[model samples]
Target: MTRKQRVLFLCRDNATLSILAEALLRELDGLHFDAFSAGLEPADRVHAAALGELRHGFSSLDLLNPKSWLEFTSEWAPEMDFVVTLCDESARVDVRAFHGTPKLRHWTLTPSAHGATHAIENAFWQILKRVEDFIAAERRPWPSSLKLPAVASCTTDACDLLLSGQ
Candidate 1:
């Protein structure tokens, strides 16, 4: 079977944009992508409004949680095909664990940290829209005839290089 491409969304907080991006891709393009999210310095908890907005479409938001990027540097972390930074604060990230030089894309956004309720909700929806467009644009029909080996057995760098189309 063809393997799904893996994507890691990152930010400074991991509580809003990254979480929402991960959840949105998993819910909408689960067949094409394996999505994950993390932050450089994680917050104590995910933003309530982001969770509430996501719950409107997804059956469950159980997977959404604040996480640290350091977790992905471990050998046990999943090999990623793409690394995306969603907030300006985390636009420049070090991605050493991913196989090869995975595609790195950054989308900068401004968060009204202390702004009104509407601003926070707007950020959630805006981020969701950007993530949706990104995944949708990259989504493609897997070559039905192409046979790939089990992803678990591949070396981290090899897996990333293979996905990089090299």
Candidate 2:
């Protein structure tokens, strides 16, 4: 079986955009990828409006409490295949090289500093749709050369199930 791709989503607070992306990707399942999220400076809790928006596309279990990027560099953290930054601030930072030598992608989004709750939710939905599209287009045969872990086997099945549902 082909290995699952591990993806990490990063944002300034790990409260809104990153959390939303992580949940959406998780809902897509184990066929193509597994996802996690973190922040440069995490918030105490995720934004309520963002959580409400995610409920429409994913399960609550997929939404994580805020965490730091430092955790992923630790021995206990999962080795990621891709590390994505979903906020402008994180995109500007240069700390793209993490422990597992993951490829980095930037999906910059405007922060919802002044928008209405509904508007913010809509923005998240749009970003998630884009992310889904990227994942679909990028699916490929797993390479034998990449030194991956055992858990990566879920990538194909989860990604397939996720795309099929959409």
Candidate 3:
């Protein structure tokens, strides 16, 4: 059997965007992907608003927790197939390379300027859209030459559509 592709999502704080992406991908395609999330500097707990948004879509959230990216630096950590940064801050943080040399992609999503709960709710939908698009792209056949570019290095709007594997 083909091995599941492992993906890690990173952000400044593992409170909202990264958490949502991890849960959405895991619930949507656990058979094909192993999803994980960590922050450069993790919060003490998952944000309450994040948990509330997740409750609407996920029944089993026992595993969700805010953790440091340092946790994945250990030899015991699974080799990631992809490392995705959800925010600009995370994409800029200098860090040691992942063991597996995973493809790096940045999905530039910012929480809405609205109040906390509304912001988390908005981020949930945005992340869910990207998560679903990512899954669909992963399932399609692609030529080896068309592998995803290092989107984290791309600082322009031109790279936005690349997330859809277009």
Off by over 4 Å in 2: 60-63, 95-97, 110-116, 141-166
TM values, all candidates: 0.77, 0.73, 0.78
Evaluate residue 166 in candidate 2 and report its C-alpha lDDT on the 0 to 100 scale: 48
Q: Which ten residues in a row have the lowest lDDT in candidate 1?
A: 111-120
Better model by lDDT: candidate 2 vs candidate 3: 3
lDDT per residue for candidate 3 within 13-111, as digits (tens), equals 898889889999999988889899999999999889888887876855888899999888788888888889988888975445678678788997764
| TM-score top scorer | 3
Model 3 misses residue 34 by how many Å?
Answer: 0.4
lDDT of 1 by residue, 50-91 (tens): 787776769548888899988887778777888998766677
**Superposed Cα deviation of residue 140, candidate 1 (Å):** 3.0
lDDT of 3 at 72: 87
Candidate 1 clashing pairs, residues 3+ apart or interchain: none
